[model samples]
Target: MEIGLNHYLVLSTLLFAIGLIGVMRRKNLLLLFFATEILLNSVNIAFAAISHYYGDLTGQLFVFFVIAIAASEVAVGLGLLIVWHKRHGNIDLDHMSTMRG
Candidate 1:
């Protein structure tokens, strides 16, 4: 059977769901960042598949921008995680409650 747009969308939905669950259940800063990345990647896959199906470049272009944003997010988020880990000795989300400004 030929793969179609529906297949890609289903996969994307599954990845997004997994990411959402990870975000909700994970307490470690690093793990949370990974979950967020999964979410971004899922959207990128959907965008690419739709672009290909419609014979348009816009969705593909958006995917490129999303990738760029995800890369920046990873850089900033990992930097923050590293610093937080060093300062607190752990990257638990619960521990961040004391960081209120």
Candidate 2:
């Protein structure tokens, strides 16, 4: 059987759910960033699938923008993560409560 839009949608939904769970359960900054990327990728997959089904380029174009944004986000986020890790020696959410202004 050929894969259809519904199959793509279901897959995307599952991916997004897993990412959401990770974001909620993870305490590490790096893992949170990874989860966010997974969420973004799921959206990209849905967009591409819908665009293909509808014979339109808008969704695909949106996916491109999403990828660009995700890339920039990763760059900035990782840089911040490094700085935070260097200052505190740990990137755990619970440990962050001890930070002072």
Model 2 residue 83 distance off true place after TM-score fit, in angstroms: 1.1
TM-scores across all candidates? 0.92, 0.93
Give RMSD (Å) of candidate 2 vs. truth.
Answer: 1.2
Expressed as tens digits, the lDDT of each residue in 6-75 for candidate 1 is 9999999999999999999999888898999999999999999999999999999999999899899888
Q: Each model's C-alpha lDDT?
A: 0.92, 0.94
Q: How much does candidate 1 score in TM-score?
A: 0.92
**Model 2: lDDT of residue 17:** 100
Q: State the weakest 10-residue window (summed lDDT) of model 2.
A: 92-101
Global fold similarity of model 2 (TM-score): 0.93
